[model samples]
Target chain A: MTNQHQEPLSAMLDDELTNNELTQALDSIKDNQQSVQTFGRYALIGDVLRKEQELVSDDSFANSIQAAIADIELPMVDQLETENVASIAKHPKWYQRASQKVVQLSEHKLLKGSAQFAIAASVALVAVVGVSNMNPGQDKITSPVLNPVPLVQGLSPVSLSSDSFKEKPTANQVTQSRINALMADHNQQLRATDDKEELEKEDKKIEQ
Target chain B: MRILFLLITCFVYSTSAAATGTATATASTKVVAPESEQLQSKEQQVQSEPQPQSEAQPQQATTPNGEKINAAYWLKKLQEALTKSNFEAGIVTLKGEKTESYQWTHGFKVNDDGTEVEIERVSPLIGNGITAIRKNQTLSFFESNKEPYSISGVSIRNFIPAIFYKDFGDLVDSYQFVLVSKSQIAGRSAQLIRVESVTKEAYNFWVWIDVISGLPLRMAYIDEQGEVVEQVLMTHLSYLTEPNEEINKLFEIQLPQVANTAIAMNQQTNNWQLEYTPNGFELLKSDRHHVSINREVADYYLFSDGLVEYSVYVQRPIESFNSPLVLKDGGTSFVMVHADGFDVTVVGMLPTETAFKIAKSVKSK
Candidate 1:
């Protein structure tokens, strides 16, 4: 029923409606509460696109919207639909109520467009930072420097102190990095050796 | 009468250990008194005699006329206490200038089907550090923000040396056992047993076993000059009759499965050979693989003299460190030497001089 009046309602906000059409749109909006809300939303969208004001009103904007959604009287809507379905034989009240719920849920969240915009902004920022940090020349020089192994590493509580020593920039980065790598590998080798020993013992037990 | 009683007890405990599959009683028979051989069946009856479970029992048994008892007996008791007792201990490991505290707990529980479960844990007393837990044969490590990993081993090699869990007879070839004077630790009387290296190449290990509970109270690595290079002291110990509530809760925790894909025994013929190894030190394994931390290929060799083990790594010559760079943390010495065509590094709980000698001995085949 509102589809016939949808054009005049939009044209009225765009200032392209004739005098007669504007008066009819005002009358329809005054009669229908849904039309009044649609008109207010259209006007806000127009103002935002034209750079009239900020999109979010306050810090608790999302919170307030969530609270409003929570306060919606779901039971009252269910009771009204059941009563309508019992009396009227035209459209099924259950279908109408289900459609109304979907509309209300989407309208109250107001997340579709805003979430996309946030994601786009983050992606662009990451691109800028990543491009700034990339150094292809340094990577080529350092890739050939392989770590020398340290044979046994006893992973202990005191190992943290040695780890901190590696964080400091030394005159020989290559040597220091190699030593760190070897020391860590040494501890790993010890654990692996223990593992191998355990497996062999198990195998011997099976043989016995 | 006292000697007869001691002999009967040792015979019973050794046979029970063998029967329970805890420790092999192969060398145990050799260490027992000759008279214990005849008292084997008689000792089985003494098991029900409410075997002296008092704190004053061991001290009374070991003093004066008890001098005939060997260190192997005390070591056997130590192994039994470690595996069978339900106790919690506060441990502090002194290494170099640092001291790390840990909460050590062990529980031996028996299932309804006659199967036994051994749960042991060593967790740092302070900061978020690696916490080791051993359930049966699986030794697991739980670290902060990292996946807990499990390796197959009978004991958690933390403050306590791994040798303590194994057969003490294995060290008979390389080390001599000596019974020292009685010492007090944490208000409890302890029996000191000193294990000296035969060749004097490895550090001497001294352990003080709690006379009553048979648990280790203090263990130290003593140098040639009788100076303690590193030590693990039991700050306090609580001997429990059954697993505590915490250990019972831990019993229900399903540990991660032991990963079978750990660096397998990849025996490869290495081109480098160690020309001079200390007496009794034999190569345990050798392989050429990419190191876990730095994907660098290295010819690695692990050597052990039963009590102590060391690793040798030979890699392609890199930027050398002042010919031989030697560093020591407690009893462990890290020695890196620049060789003819390759760089060699020797790391283990051995003396610096010994480590350096081993590092320099690496020669190309």
Candidate 2:
């Protein structure tokens, strides 16, 4: 369950791994669903680390690659006909590889220039995904990630967030009923804004 | 060639979404208005609007400062276009994976005395005749149900955000507005205004207004990470000079029977008060409802900052043993916490931190 291979996946994305190591990492991503998903997550982490927020990522990309991998016995490294892989491989495009690594390195320099975002990758990642997958009693995972790095000012810290929580019935649905009662109150507020008379009443409250 | 391109694109973007936080917006939906029936479909959308109590106050049409293009100006334009103009627009609302298309029309009639009345109707483009109409404060429902009742409101409360119709100054303390960019939407030049929060970075709003009409063409709610969570885009827009005969006739159209119910008030108040609330957001109302003869009483307080709103509920702690809980759906956040012998739930589109803070703030009054 641990994301132990993220560093390797990170290196593989940068085209830095030796040929044998690259082959092994790609094979792991091809065979293991979790590895593929983790690689996808790492690629995203790399993008954030690189500060390339303009490029749009495709969510279905990993799934499509996984599905293709399940169907094809041959590895995808040789199937990249669109890329000049054969000639590049024959000529050892040393400058292309070096310049690309330099760009990735400069991405690190760009990240380094903003000391505020030095801890951006790990802290912000959990905040983004943790906000979506938040669950109670899971503070062990969500809380520790946010403790050290105080979020940017003007932004409040989310101590608790969950996608959905299934209440373990407590005192005959008292929790759920209270939640519904609040929404019912909100419904009244929604109606109040649309009613001119009620609005005047609110305006009077604000004036007072 | 397509597969080759797809494979390359896939590898290039697949893992990169996590880092950049920019996911491709789904393909833009296209709705073409048939030239003959766009506004002529008075049989559907063209009606009058909500209560006219506020319409009596008429300000100068445009300021003498030569059209100050600030947030206040655009908001004023939006309000004017909504209430002053007669038009039909095709609206598409996208929230998460849910998309709904609806037809909206507004018609205004000014009497000789100078007071204006409006008729408005909204019906989903695909449905079994679920339509809502507002004719001077009586919002009548026209569903297939045997009995239809009218509600007291200035306008139909759905389809459009409630904040758009209100004065923009109230929201000043909560959000700062900066005109962001100019783009084309619904075949019209659009100006985008970025409405980011002053206190919380959890959510923001982008409102795209039509430059000519000053009407909102599109609006979206984005999270702090620069991702649009919910949005509404107008597909077709047409302004009318005068109300058509059908819309004029709707002024006297028969409405469903009004419901007979007295407003009830529950007197029970929990020993609770909110410790902190964002500026300009005030308590609109407090209500107490007893589920079982006042034994399991829940107190509700609703708060709003003009355009954005959230609610707080306080009641006795549930038997379940757990820490604080937070959940999000679409643009809204729901938080639950245990405080001062009460289990509280704060629900609205506010950030989880704000909601949780409000939830835990309930204390003995």
Candidate 3:
């Protein structure tokens, strides 16, 4: 079977075959691993050419298509040949290099001008925002003077005490205890006055 | 960031310090009243005296006919005399803590419409010397300073009794009446009757009745501590007559020019009503009048028993520098309150408590 498939595939490869014979050879190679690898190389070359056509039309589309093609698993020889062609295409011949350098210099000049414009725009935006934040609603606006100390710091202690007092009866108990002490003192004074009066009455009775 | 934090801390410290300082100040101040003891002594003197020895002996006062002089008989006689007497008196009211005096000559006339009209001439005893004359449907203030300010509402007769008769029977009901020793009042020997309220909160009253005419000569109100709160002495009373030349002259005095503006304002905005008052206290006449100074409208309702006249004033709150509640000039007290939608001011020689209650009860719609 392998020998029979090779005769037709070689014929098809030499272009000495009909379309039917070539389709048959291609079908037979689908099940044969070594023939399938050779067929894959031919398909890759076609794919590269189709991709190159799409790339020349739209640059973004071309970059995406190229990235997709680069991700494919090509045979070792094809991969080596593609890389060599890509390097040659990047480095060009001496005359082409000179023309490419000229084009690159012009692009560099345009890019530099755009970059300067972008930088200036960004600087202007920052300055506007900074000035607005610094001085809002001019004429009637008054600048806020920053205090030296945090306002909340002095309030924290009293707030803590008030919160604690609300949670318990300690403050009320203290007030009630003070009231009890004063009442007790008043009672003592009244009792002492009564005792002194009684003693004075007893002395007057004895003298009588 | 450091400055911001410092500012916040300083603000907190100052606020807390202020709060603590207020608390400390409130705590540290000790009120000392050097004259309190002296006032108490004076109050004791007024209360403890005139304690009738007969209170201990209840059976001694029974007549030979065996009819006990009961509370009902005394109250009935007092009410009858009050209803019948053609009593009139010139009154002076002193507002509490105020230096100004308001003198008004008040008289009551029973109108043909079965209502009573009380005429009051409010004359300033001191500066500007303006007299505000009020008659039924006619109000004129005689003032050298401005135009004779005038506006008309209800008459003074409908206004006075509404103020004087709040809980009219309350004094008779709350107190135990005792016919005490005789006293001289208004140059006549009078029967002194002591009416003490059963409750400690009640103020006692001493009413002197004329021995021959049985008319009330004077009435004295004593506070809870038996301090004399006020005294009303009825003298120089004359029966009502047709409008005389002298009466016309008295009513013709105009209010001061400054007061004309106030009277006009007062005439524009006062609505007052009284629901129920005792019998014999008839609304003689009512009038709307303008007050010059504050430009307020006043409704004066006058009521009388052919004798004693009372006036109730419904107007805007009179702006006063001193006590707004008590306007006492001369011997009378004018109790004023801002209530409902209007300022209620009732001035008379009646007890201050009665005046206050009446002023407070005035409902404005």
TM per model? 0.60, 0.54, 0.27
List candidate 2 stretches off by more than 4 Å.
A1-185, A193-208, B1-69, B110-116, B127-130, B245-249, B256-262, B267-270, B290-296, B320-323
Q: Tens digits of per-residue lDDT for model 2 on B1-365? A: 32222111011112221211111100000011222333322322211112113221112233233322466666777777776656677899875556789888777766679766778888889876567777766778777764666776666656566777766776777788886655766445566888777766347888997654566889898877788877888888765545655457766677775565745667556457789886667877677865332345668777777676787777777766464866666677778787867778788877677778787777878
Q: Pick the TM-score winner.
A: 1
DockQ each:
0.14, 0.14, 0.01
Between candidates 1 and 3, the one scoring higher on TM-score is: 1
**How would you encode candidate 3's per-residue C-alpha lDDT over B102-166 as one tens digit per residue?**
44444444557867554555566677855666664354556786767554422222112221212
lDDT of 3 at A61: 37
| Model 3 chain B: ten consecutive residues of lowest lDDT | B5-14
lDDT of 1 by residue, B41-102 (tens): 34333442343233234334444455324587788788888877677889999988778999
Q: Looking at candidate 3, what is the lDDT of residue B153?
A: 28
Instruction: Considering only chain B, report the TM-score of each candidate against the true chain B.
Output: 0.81, 0.73, 0.36
The CA root-mean-square deviation of candidate 1, after full C-alpha superposition on the true structure, stands at 19.3
Q: Write the per-residue lDDT of candidate 2 for residues A71-161, one digit (tens) a residue.
A: 3222222322223222322233432342333233223333322222222332333223322223344434422332334346774322212
User: If ranked by TM-score, best first, what sequence of candidates would result?
Assistant: 1, 2, 3
